[model samples]
Each structure stands twice: as structure tokens, then as C-alpha cells.
Target chain A: MPHDHHDHLSPSGHPYRPDQDGPLTYWQAMEIAIRELMVEKGIVTAAQVREQIDAMDARSPAQGAAFVARFWTDPAFRDLALRDGSNACAEMGFEVGPMRLIALENTSRLHNVVVCTLCSCYPRNLLGLPPDWYKSRAYRSRTVREPRKVLAEFGTILPEGVELRVHDSTADMRYIVVPRRPDGTDGWQPDRLAKLVTRDSMIGVAEALPATEAPA
Target chain B: MADFAPGARVRVKAMMPPGHVRTPGYLRGRVGEVERVLGPFPNPEQLAYRRKGDPLDLYRVRFPLGDLWDRDDADTLEAEIYAHWLEPA
Candidate 1:
């Protein structure tokens, strides 16, 4: 039997679920009502809503990886990112909406991790939608209180000398952890270096992939 | 005008208002230093009620993990807190 990819997988390669086919949730019902009202009232069109969804769906971790790669290779950009994350991302052609972004740099002595203790506020415009675990109650509650334990759950272990800094996105500001560039990629270009910058690394769950492990 | 400047010691006010408050429960009454003054932004509490929230000064406060928890490590935690939820410590 031939396996039809379209029937089982979404465009992003994740398994597709028949959400609309299932019993409509309360939130989904409310969303439908609001969208219909807005469209009927000429506030917005269905086309515009679809376009917005398409725009958001287009964003992914690849964008953040590119920014990290640039930050690693360019000294001036790195300084700018540390000073003003929004502007630095804009300089790289990624518009991060209205929310203020703060770039946390990981050094030999310090490691930075970001979590939204109050809610699942993330740098969505830069890194796309957060993973399901990021929005879980356990992650939101424990990451601030027992971050070392949470990092260990993600298979990340730091040395005794390295200090960990957890940035809780409690309010309006969003955060991005600039994981330290791996060794042995001294003269690698940003495009190549981006392959080593994984999504988990940017979230501070894990370090950047080693230079030797970068995709060929 | 900002009430607290960067590096100023401040404490998260231990308030439990039953609305859209941004201050986390664990941080209430906890003391920390203002890492930076992030300028005024619309207060989320008021905005949640569909009111035009008057802008409030927001600050990044850094607390030592030991102070936050019973941990022996030297890790630290930073959170963005609105000025209204903070008091001079």
C-alpha cells in the first residue's frame, strides 16, 4: 500500500490531527464567533485572518538560528544584540513585532535560560510557537524555582564554576539565549555555523551542537 | 517618571489581587536589585479589563537563586516587574 504524506503529515512534518473534525472546544467556538462578527462588521476579512495565520506559520526556529549565527560571527552585531535585541533582529531582516526582546549572552562563566513563569510568553515572532512543554504547568512553575533540575531533565548539565541565570518572561519583555559558540569553527561562515545553533540551544535547554556534528 | 533607577534594591510587593497581575507568586516580597529600568508600558492589570492602562515603569530585577530557594548553588533569576508591584527595600 502506498503511504500518502498529505493524509498523515502537516507541512512542517509534524503529524496532523483532525482538530476541526473533533468536537469543537469552548475556546474554538468563541474564536469562530468572534471571527465571524469581526468579518461581518468589516473590521477584518477572512482573507486577512488567513494571511495572518500564514505569516505566523511561516516563522520557525531557523530564523533565530540565523540571528544566532550572525551574532556569533559578527562582533558589532553581537554588541547591538546585547544592547537592543529588537533592533539587532531587525538589522538581520527579522521583524519581531512590538514586544521588547532581550538577548542573554552565554559566556564561559555564565549560562542563560528563558522561561515565562507567569505565562507561556515567548519570542514567537523570532522562534515561532513555543513547544508544548514550554506551556505546561510543570515547566512554567518549576523552571524558576529549580532550573538546574529542569536543565538536567533536558540532558543539560553545567559545571560547578558556571553560574546559571534564568530569565522569567513575566511581563512584556521576551528573551533569547545566545548560546556560546562551539569550538573548532573558528573561520566558519554564518550559514554553516547556523547548522550548529539548534532550537533547544537558543532556549538554553542545551548547548550548541559541536562543530564536528554540524550537518555536512 | 521612573520611581526606581537601575541597580536600586527593591522588593516585590506581596499583593494577591485576584486579577491579571503579572507579578509571580514566588517573587512576592522577595528582594532583588534592579538590573535595568525598561521604561513605561501599559499596565496589564488595567488592560486585561479593557481599560486604557496608564503606562507604568517596568524594571528587570535580578534575585539570587539562594534567596528564592533553599539551593546551595550560585545561580540567579531575573524577572520583569512593573513599578507598582515594587517597593524600595
Candidate 2:
């Protein structure tokens, strides 16, 4: 489909003169020109183009970290997280709305899990923005096909006896992998737990950092 | 397609359209190789913007570590890139 140029460019690029263009950088002019031409000819409407742009422009959820902390404190809530993942968050006063959230827990059965076979479908509400590498094609294609090799690059080479399951997220729904808090963080409070469930854990790329280790 | 093969060198024009779904911001106008050409794809990016119905041509570009970014990410491994051509390369 012939889309507007502004859509493909990422947040890294900002306009040269923000005072006039609202800090919007001309990341790529060719794609944008192609899109504007199509719109000018009535092939597509500006309203329709904006609709998709709006979805991309959606903000990260506010309550995500709080919910992760809630589950960390309540063993019962953690079990609920294992069951229907969204309900667990909702019970703790967080909602995903139309978007879905999948929970990948590190358990005895499996040590780690992650998403992205084709594209990046992260848990925006729980996790803030995705890392730059997540948006890169290297991470997108390698994570699912070679989870072990890719995980190692992230400094997470698994030990013997741990099984890795890679998940592929579609355009619909978001996913979060609850990293089992490290051994040192036993008596930590919910606030501390919130700190533990870093964005990497939510992406299933890196496990949550212990209270001792800094948030990834 | 002169001497064009998978893993050959190419660079994208430093231009973007208004409603396109493209590679992330950090990867514009960078040079890389044609890792694997995915042929034509149903462009989810253009569709996401509610754009036209024309299918996109996909190419998997492989770039060396020293080329894309300079970091201690890993000395051994290489980076892979993916993009769909809007017109001809």
C-alpha cells in the first residue's frame, strides 16, 4: 500500500527546525512525497492516513509497572498472571483495553521466552518504549529463529536444563514476560518490585534485574 | 541487476513519504548488503496507514558491525537489515 512518508520514520528523527514543524524531522522525504501524491489525487484520504498514524502514535500505558509490582507482592496475583494474563493486571487496577497482553513466565518447565517472528509487538502499556535494537530487523528475525544465539548476545545464555520458548506476536495484542525476581530481592516491597519488572522483562528479551542489579 | 546477488551492497535514498511503514529511524541512508530478498509482501506498513493496496517488495539486508554502529555489542556477529523498495533500487 502507498503510505505517507511520516509513518515509516521512527522517533529518532526529528524536524530540523522544531519551532515550525513541531520537532518533526524529515526522516525520509521520498516515502512521504509518494504518500502525499496519492492523497492529493484522492486515491486515499488524509483522515484515513491519520488513523493508522494515530495507532503508531499511541502512548505507553501508565499502570503497567504498578501491575507488575502488584503481582510480585501477591503470589495469588502471580498465579492469575499465569492463567488469564490480562485479568491479573485488571484485578490490580490496570486494563489493556482492545490490545491484548501475553505473559511469559520463567518457570522450572521453561527458563525464558520472547516475542517477534516478523515485527515488534511489545507490551506498550506495561513497558514504555522498546529499545532501538528491538525495532531493528536483526532482533526481529533472529529472536524467533535463533532464540538461544540471540539471547546470548543480550548476555543471557541459558544454563543446561533451561528450555527456551520463542513466541511470535501478531499485529493485534501486546505481550509481557514476568521475569522471576532475582534471588537477592526477597523482602523487597511492591515499589521495589516495580523497579525489577524492567522494560526488558516485559519484552521477554532480558529478565528483570534483581534489587542488586540495575534495571535493564 | 548488475552483479546483484543476495548479500550485495546497496543504500536506500535518504527520503521518506508521508504515510509509509519503514525501517526504524536509526537506519536511514545507511549502506548494507542484500541478505535475502523476500520478494513481494502485502505491505502491512502502508496498510497500517490505510494506504493503497499495492504489495511491497521485501529485501533482507545484512550489514557488518563496523558499518551500522560502532559499539562493543559483539565483535563476532553481523547485523541484518530489512526494507521494501518503493520503486527500483
Candidate 3:
């Protein structure tokens, strides 16, 4: 499924700043004003802001999928990821910042899903900023109350005997779901397998696609 | 420092102290097992407001999914909770 990448801008791309009386919300205007003031005051340079944005923009689900694929193929790495997710990512050349990263593995009997009930805290260093649905209040409130229904909406149907575990990220920590590898792709290499991993699957909403269904 | 280990029974305190708190309302008074010690970190409740304080032990508490909801869906609900909000059940 195509992900939503909505942005507030006209097709022509003529700049629309809050100061120019465009459609910017009050809070958005205030944020821009404060940011400009901070830049003016030398508290934070505009270059620093751009650098941070660039770093986040450079990240994608591909990085996270690579780790999950590695875990699926390498039992020793899976142990390391489950034991210290942040270190494991670092060992793989991914920096997860100061926040702790926890990798939850999905097995035949148990499945794990992640949500930030209080706020939209996520593992941005690995998966980039969370999708819009993940930050929705409905998702935040419903996932804990009725996780099965939520997963069903995402087109994920668990086996009758399997259990669903919802992980609410409350503090500085972030979680990534290590989805169970699909059958029939037993001898596939990690690169080929990574293509089957989706952002939703890593969030525990859907399962990885089978070899036949995976994209070329 | 964390006082509890995995498999330890812990209950979230039901009280709602006034101020910024990271504890979710639904989990309060709920019983769960310590899934793991998530290590110590700066108290976010204080850090959110720029108040200085010592780091506190954080833990991942796992509760049976069936116990938290009335639905028949079987699963576990695990959340990361600061050690201060938990007590031996």
C-alpha cells in the first residue's frame, strides 16, 4: 500500500509562510516565528536544523528491514538485538541516539504491536518519523483497548491460537517489532528477504508478505 | 537502581499525583510481571519541564492481554514504566 506523504503546499510551490497570510495554522506560525527567532539569537543555527532534517529524511524503513532480516537469518544477532537493541543497531552502523531501542520478536504463539499512548514517540533513527496513522489519537486509544480489531483493520489476521501484545511507549524508549519470517522463503538471502518487510509489519500491524506476493 | 527482576510481580500505584506524569491511566492499579529491567534514565516527568533530578530505573512490565480487556483475543500487553510508579504486588 502506498503511504501517505501529505504536505501543505500548492502544486506550483509558491512559498506560503504564515507571515504571508497563507493557510498556516496559528501554532504552525508561532513555531516558525520562534524558530526564526532562535536562529536569529544564535541559539540554534538554521544549518543545524537542516542537518537534523537531512539525517531524519535519509532514514527509511529499509534500514529497519535490514536489521529484522538479519535477525531472522542470524540467531546470534537475534539474541543480541533482543538483549540490547540500541547496541545491535549501532553494531549495524545505525545510530539510535540516546533513547533506548527495544526489539520485540513475534513468534507463533505471541505477536507484538507498538504504540505511544501519551505522545508520538518512535524510533525515528531507524524507521524515520512515524506514519500519520501511528500518531492518530484513534490509533493511540484503540490499540490498547482493542488491538485485535486494530490489527484486523490493517489487514492482519492472526492465527486463532496466537496472542497479541501491545507495547505502549511511554517514556524515552522506542520499540520495533521483529515480525516472524514467512514460510517457503527458507533459503532466501537477507537482501531478498528485506524486500518483503513492510513498515506496518515492523509495527506489528501486518505480517511480512510471502515470497510469491513480494515485489520484484 | 532497579530492585525487581524479570518474573517479579508488580502492581502500578493507583494514585494520581498532580504534575506531569508519564503513567497511563488505564495501567494504573493493574498487575503485571517485570518483563525486563530497561535500565535507568532521566526522569521524563521532570525532564519535560526542564526540572533537574536523578535518573530512575525503568522497566518493561508485561500483563496478560486477556486481563486488560474483555475481548477473547489472547495476547500480552507490555509497557515501559518507571520503577517509581510500581510496587510489589
In the range A34-139, model 3's lDDT, one tens digit per residue, is: 9999999999999999998898777889889999999999999999999899989998998768798999999999888999999898888778779989999999
TM-score of each model, paired residue for residue: 0.90, 0.52, 0.87
Docking class of 2: incorrect
- lDDT of candidate model 1 versus the reference: 0.91
Stretches of candidate 1 off by over 4 Å are: A1-23, A41-43
**Candidate 3 or 1, higher lDDT:** 1
Model 3 chain A: worst 10 consecutive residues (lDDT sum) = A1-10
User: Which DockQ values do the candidates obtain, in the order shown?
Assistant: 0.88, 0.03, 0.80
Q: What interface RMSD do all candidates show, one decimal each?
A: 0.6, 9.3, 1.1
Evaluated against the true structure, the overall lDDT of model 2 is: 0.59
Candidate 3 docking DockQ: 0.80
| Among all candidates shown, the one with the greatest DockQ | 1
Residue pairs in candidate 3 whose N, alpha carbon or C atoms collide under 3 angstroms? A164-B75
- lDDT string for model 1 (A1-216, tens) is 244646687656667666666788999999999999999999999999999999888878898999999999899999999999999988988886889889999999999999988779989877898999999999988888889899999999988899999999988898999999999999999999999998889899999999989898
State the lDDT of candidate 1 residue by residue for B1-84, as single tens digits.
689888999999998999789898999999999999996899999999999999999999999999988667689999999999
